[model samples]
Target chain A: METSSPRPRAERARQVADVLRQRITAGAFDDGPLPDEHTLGTQLGATRNAVREALGLLRAEGLVERRQGVGTLVVHPKYGHGLDRLVGLAEALDGYGDVVNEVRSVGIVTPPPATAERLGLVPGAPAVHLERLRRLGGVPLSLDTTYLTADIGVPLLDHDLAGRDLFALIEETSGRRLGRADVVVHAVTAGPDTAALLDVAPGTAVFALDRLTHLDDGRPVDAETLHIRADRLTLRATLHRGPA
Target chain B: METSSPRPRAERARQVADVLRQRITAGAFDDGPLPDEHTLGTQLGATRNAVREALGLLRAEGLVERRQGVGTLVVHPKYGHGLDRLVGLAEALDGYGDVVNEVRSVGIVTPPPATAERLGLVPGAPAVHLERLRRLGGVPLSLDTTYLTADIGVPLLDHDLAGRDLFALIEETSGRRLGRADVVVHAVTAGPDTAALLDVAPGTAVFALDRLTHLDDGRPVDAETLHIRADRLTLRATLHRGPA
Candidate 1:
């Protein structure tokens, strides 16, 4: 579709975004507010239009906090969940130790057909279900609902989760070591019920992650569906490229 | 974020959602409307209340689209771009060749400072800028704004892009083979200008991708920022895991 080129405004914004991103990362304005539009434009020899555009990009990247009356302030560090390893919510939210886990429920129930098939169970088989809410500094961060087949889940239900480490509990009860896991990350709007739990409006975009873990012998041990607040969390990963 | 454990209604909804998802994916109602609430409840042995809750989940996933009076119909196939490769938009949308390219503008301009730095150019150096709109079946699909430095970008300016393949033109004109690219994918809301361009309402969620491509010898060749409608496309990737 060949038509007229885009307006120069966007190009200018890209330039601003690039420069500001570096300055922020290099700690030029460490823990400080960004200069006003006039000052910043003068300092960078960029038009105020460009600087404003750049700030929008930075805010979209979750790099700065912009308030109407308050100046543009650098937001405090946020949690970064790495995609390379199998990390739990507690481990992912490490820098912020002011975290708590509230186990909402635990019981045995008929497994969903798809999940039952994944766990190599009969269609009507019962599975152990666990629902837990993870909070950071008393604010909801994520809600995790996990399904485990009875062989391992039954033992897990009998164990106390005062510590809230489901993996450890599963390993101890099932006597199986987690070998590897497959994680699928995608986005979904919060349903009414999820919105109430996560303290967000219904239809707000959220990170929906599904994880399937396996035992050393290649047995599926556990499956978890985790819904995380997108605003408070950013998942990071490096996609390596090699010669074709 | 301690609050009520969420209503039992949520739990019931999830159970319904889970069962219905399997049915849909299994082609139980392929290309057809889902059974009405009463019919569905009777078939799955679930309460009508739960069936209604489940439909909401399906609607959000774009699996089954709802109409005011007609009925809920299954959506057609969707595109899934893999993150593992550096695929041009034209190549990614090859299955639908009816897509037209509208080049917004083409010219030499002052390189945005940060982009200049990344491209190894001195500050204020001129770069080639190309803005384009991509439409599929006469419907706007994405907006692409690309930045190319002069040394390589100049020669390609004279080449014809009637085929809508800029990468090929660049390769032929610059005499350089494409190597690898690093792409970052994230979500952002469509601001006023962007919304108008893509024909979407303001604040609609869109997928933003930033790609930096390099030459065979590791020289940066092009940098592009592409905005795509999320509801129209989903990026798929298989994340492999091993011990760190």
Candidate 2:
């Protein structure tokens, strides 16, 4: 719906695109191709021009594609990853497909200063360093690099990392449950190495998550940095207002 | 810290950059310029070559800059916004600076289909629409477009929107305590118009937040789309792990 005052065409297009994007992601068009621009315009009570512009925006986002004769089609579907829960990639994407971890590297090494601090490791102490290329349904989703305290990390080196989540392995090995995590989420342009791993063009926007996970006793044990493909994952949260 | 096996130089640089970026954002360099590459390399237990490349990476991210005569300097400080809490921009950046809202437009209008559905308005029902350019310390931070149910939104026009957050005004006007919000966060390239408003170049990566806030009784009242400058804000959260 248009505002009372005249707004820029681009803004109007964005509004329409927002609505269409939500509907597309919600599987409104799973049965068949999307309606024509004229139909979408009438359905959303937007101008035909705005609807066309909105479709163009969606096309650029790689969510939908315009075919010469097949009409508009939903090209990619993004999976929602809940940010309120401290879950592993496999647990988070449960029911989507089997999340396979390709363990690129795993060894005992010196962690960076910040990682060492987060994991509460003593200076000069060795920690387990693990690098994984995580995939869902055979498509790369994230590149995860993790540092763990030596006590628990050393045991994980012998576990089946590809078939199970690290959280599970940590608990099984140390008998300590994961309690919580402090996470920082930001957008970063994909570098050449990351882009190659995630199979995206260099400079594409991706979600960078830096997290420090703690044991149930409040001892930090895991520090991870994850570069997730933005087009494939959406971070979701339900937040409550605290006292002012 | 280097792994036991040799890794790519670029990957090593990224690891160093991550640690340095965290330290920079934590105000580790407030007293002076960053240490020389050799000193930093020793501090982080990385090679001088990797430290040099790390500084280069930070320079590209606009987090740090290297001067010809002077040393590296932290260019921009990012404000961390708690994603676990439902608060206005002003509240999120309380200690940073005064968050001023520049109301670009406010009026009653027909909302898009999804907006109307989210707000639970009947077909053809009117809702209050607001567009605000939010700034921190006189610099643009976010572009907020909001839609509210008519019952709570109609009276907001008379409130001091520019000086106060909408959450405060909504509660004051509707006499309804706000409860929770559903938020979705992702990254998008800024369009030409949005880039102009946020004083960034076109195609700059920005955080796009879509939120639907509800009243204490679970009635959704406010729906918003926020385009936040990525360099100026970082989203933080403390997440708990649920039972397996």
Candidate 2 lDDT over residue span A1-244, tens digit each? 3335345788888778777876775678866789998989988989999999888876766567788888999865778889888888888888989999988888988887767877888787899999898998788999998989999899888899888999988989998789999998877667677778899777666787888899988999898889888778889899997676
Compute fnat per model.
Answer: 0.14, 0.60
On lDDT, the leading prediction is 2
Instruction: Write model 1 residue lDDT over B140-218, tens digit each, in one string.
Output: 7777777787878888777764346777677778777777776655455555566678886655556666667777778
Clashes of each: 14, 0
Q: What local lDDT score does residue B178 receive in model 1, on the 0 to 100 scale?
A: 76
For the record, the alpha-carbon RMSD of candidate 2 to the native fold, in angstroms, is 2.4
What overall lDDT, based on C-alpha atoms, would model 1 receive against the true structure?
0.67
Residue B129's lDDT within candidate 2 is 89
The stretch of ten residues in a row with the least summed lDDT in candidate 1 chain B is B235-244
Highest DockQ scorer: 2
Interface RMSD of 2: 3.0
- What TM-score goes with each of the models? 0.77, 0.93
